[model samples]
Target: MAVKVAIFDWDGTLVDSVEHIADSLHQAATELGYPALERAAYRNIIGLGIEEALESLYPGITRADMQAMREGYGRYFFTKATTPREVFAGVTEMLADLRGAGLGRAVATGKSRRGLDKALVSSGLGVHFDITRCADETRSKPDPAMLGEILRFYRIEPDEAVMIGDTIYDMEMAQRIGMPAIGVEWGVHDQDTLAAFGPKAIVDSMADLRRALELL
Candidate 1:
């Protein structure tokens, strides 16, 4: 079936926030008195929930320590939030094309509910999405709950929706639901990493994505 719903990821997919994200993780690690984590350590967990990501990086930390790290990351991020980053080229056009094709637009993100909400308005794409599910509100990526909820909300089956994202977590989550996944190269994970999760296609640019999804 043709894709009637296009579910997107926020951070590295639509917008470019890797620098800020890395800085926040570093600050959080520092605040928690953990030695600064290597870039690769934190970068790989970008698609997970705050608790899950921190736990993955620190593996042996206590609940309180995780909470402290989470809080510190949020604080550090907000403090550095000066100018908002623009979405990838043709992103707005992509959304418009999807809308014009009568395809439903949604977001399944690793960010917290508040973080996703803030990004929606700040990025000026709030009006484009018909639904959004955040990490705090559901099981994080690589789990199918978020995609399942979106499909249920729209009363559509997995095949009718396409997951568009930049990370392996996003691809894995879609695979769990038997939905098609399209990976983007500009995100946290490289093409090979995302490909191992079995995406339908991995596009190098927004233009290529348009062709892959037939958004045009």
Candidate 2:
């Protein structure tokens, strides 16, 4: 079947916010007196929902502590972090090309609704998406719930849509539903890690991504 919609992951996929995310997570842990993890440890959890990511990072955290960490991370990410949250090079053009081709554009991200909304406005990429699903609003990545919802909303089968992201979580979620996925190299996980999930292609640049989309 021809691809009708392209579902994207935010953070490292579309925006260059990985460092900021890692730094914010570190700050959050510090604020809560949690043990600091390596940058790679924080990056590895990029595609998971905040709570899920926290649990993965800090096992045995209480519910109250989890809430505090969430809030602390939010404050640092939204206000304190100095890292620029610019959109990746060619992302705007890629999205515009998808629009030109009449392919539906959407985001399935681990970010909360509030975080995504703010990002959408700041990035000016909001209008490009036809729909978006946040982790806080639905099941996080690797679960297939968010991807399932996007497929249903578009009334398209899993094969008719493609999930493009930089993490194994995104690839795994799409894989569970038998959907085609394209992995990008600029995100949380490396090519080998993403390849383990059996994506249709692993691209290093937006131009390569466009070509991969065509071949799919």
Candidate 3:
């Protein structure tokens, strides 16, 4: 059966914004008097929402501190980041191909609407997704709310769509919803870690992902 919708996990999957994410996180940590999170620590929290990331980085941080950190990170990221984030190679082409195939493409992400919009716009891929859901509106990932919303929006069964992401949160969400998932290796999560989530397959490159999607 043909897949009707392709739901993507944004940050690491479509755009290589992990470095920006981590840099902002580090700046936030410094502002809050917490130690900066290294890339590995940042990687583990990438798929989850900002709250989860802050909680993981500062295990006992107060609510006030969390709010401060979140705001601080956004300020730094939206301002200090020099180069605009670029979409991964072949992502635009692949999305165009999927759209041409009469497939609906949506982004289900942990980023808030503003953050998601900024990333997509900066990457010049905002025109690709037909629908988008961010952490601000839905329950965070591994909860299935966003993916469920995507399925509902497209009016398609879980089997009619595939969730593609680079994190365990993405795979876990797909699994809980009984949806097939594809993991990408070039993203934040390690392939082994992503494999543990029981994705339908893991592709090493976006080109490989395009092939995996069978977009001819």
Candidate 4:
């Protein structure tokens, strides 16, 4: 089916912020007098919202501790963020092409509304996406609510939209919602893992992603 709407995941899909995310979490933990999270452990929770990520990482965490982590991590992430973030090569052109081709662009991400909003403005890509759904604004991924909302908002059926993302959460979310999804290898999870969720295709680069979306 041809894609009328293109939904993307922010962190790993459009912007290469894996290191930033991991490092910021580490810094926040240190500042909050908690032990630093292992690199792999931090990497594993990239697609979840801050609260969910904290809960998943620190199983018995109290609400107060979670709030502290959130504030600390957010402070470090925002202050250190160079603004607009570094986008993958060809992303600008890809978004421009998608817009020019008359496709509606949106974001369904694990980032909080504030985080995603700051990124959109900083990265200057806000104009490309007509609508965006964040984890804070809806249920987290693998649940399908975000995609369902996006589909409903645009009056587009699940089959008419293509979810382009980089994680298992993304694939499972779209799959459960009856939407076709394509994975990007350049994100947080490996190709094998993303493929495990049965994406329509998995592309390794932004160029490949653009090509795949074109085919869709």
Cα-based TM-score, every candidate:
0.95, 0.97, 0.94, 0.96
User: Residues 102-136, candidate 2, lDDT per residue (tens digit)?
Assistant: 99999999999999988888888998999999998
lDDT per residue as tens, model 1, 1-216? 288899999988988887788889998888768988788777889989888898888889999888888888888877743234467777888898788878899999999998888878877888889999999998988898999999999999999999999899999999989999999999899988989988888999888898898841
Please list the residue runs of candidate 2 whose C-alpha ends up more than 4 Å from where it truly belongs after superposition: 80-85
TM-score comparison, 2 vs 4, better candidate: 2
**What is the lDDT for 106 in model 4?**
92
Which residue runs does candidate 4 get wrong by more than 4 Å?
82-85
* lDDT (Cα atoms) of all candidates against the true structure: 0.87, 0.92, 0.84, 0.87
Candidates 3 and 4, the one with greater TM-score? 4
The lDDT-based order of candidates, best leading, equals 2, 4, 1, 3
- In model 3, the Cα lDDT at residue 199 comes to 83
Per-residue CA lDDT of model 4 for 31-134, tens digit only, reads 87778777988888898888888888888889898898899889888985535548888888888988898889899999989888888888888889989999
RMSD to truth, every model: 1.7, 1.7, 1.9, 1.3
Candidate 4 has its poorest 10 consecutive residues by lDDT at 80-89
